[model samples]
Target: MLLQHAGIRPHPDYRRLMRALRLHAASPRGELAPEVYPADVANFFRRRRIPVAIVREGNTNALRKILAQVRRAPVMALVRGPEWGNEDHWIVLIGEERGMLVYLDPWYRPTQRYRRRMTNPVFALRWRGSAFSLSRGQAQSVRRA
Candidate 1:
């Protein structure tokens, strides 16, 4: 999704990379256990020469700071409970709407087919907020500064 947003198409091995990332899964205990390490996200982009700045587990205030500094849309992915699907969800943060955060939701399934959404910084219980914003690009950058 990030690559696409940056106008770069993934070469066909993306599925292999997703498997390697081990994103979205269930534990024997049947809890929400997605291994979405921010560094992993960063590493993938780094390989493509796209610098990514990861925001640690944080709150709306932290997000505000990121929104102010990002050159590209930030990727927000959070882990939710069973009621909210018990899987980690990812959204591309666009900007602010009214007082809410506006984002591009890439999820589309029989259960969830939401796209182009807006939400409160914290829309209730489920949020393990981890985000990564692409930094300002230099001459040899992927986003073609």
Candidate 2:
């Protein structure tokens, strides 16, 4: 979705990406916990020549500015809720309304999601702390394939 938003008509194969990154290794108990975290995503983007900027609570003002520029920035936020059962989930930040953040949940479980908007307190309630915005990769160094 972020790739499409950034004008990559055919998004990269996510399955292949996971395999390349060696993600989702199962434990001896046969528990598969797929971990495609914020840092991993950032590295992927950088590897694929897609520029992205990470923001966190440490830089609240800058992050807030990025959040406000939804369409222009194309942001994805990492959040955790009771619905995820101690796991983190990533959602697209669409817009801001009435001082609340409007997000789109891409979680597999539909029943877990309730509404789409959240204020600062509400965001805190969900343990959302990090976000990244897609931008110009042209300025960054390109890797030789």
Estimated TM-score per prediction?
0.60, 0.72
lDDT of 1 by residue, 76-126 (tens): 555465645777666666666666666655555536755444455453344
Candidate 2 residue-wise lDDT, 8-112, digit = tens: 534446676665444756756787756666677777667766666777766757555655657575678787877677678887777777888777777635577
Which pairs of residues have clashing backbones in candidate 1? none
| lDDT for each candidate structure | 0.56, 0.65
lDDT of 2: 0.65
Error of 2 at 133 (Å): 1.3
RMSD of each: 5.5, 4.1
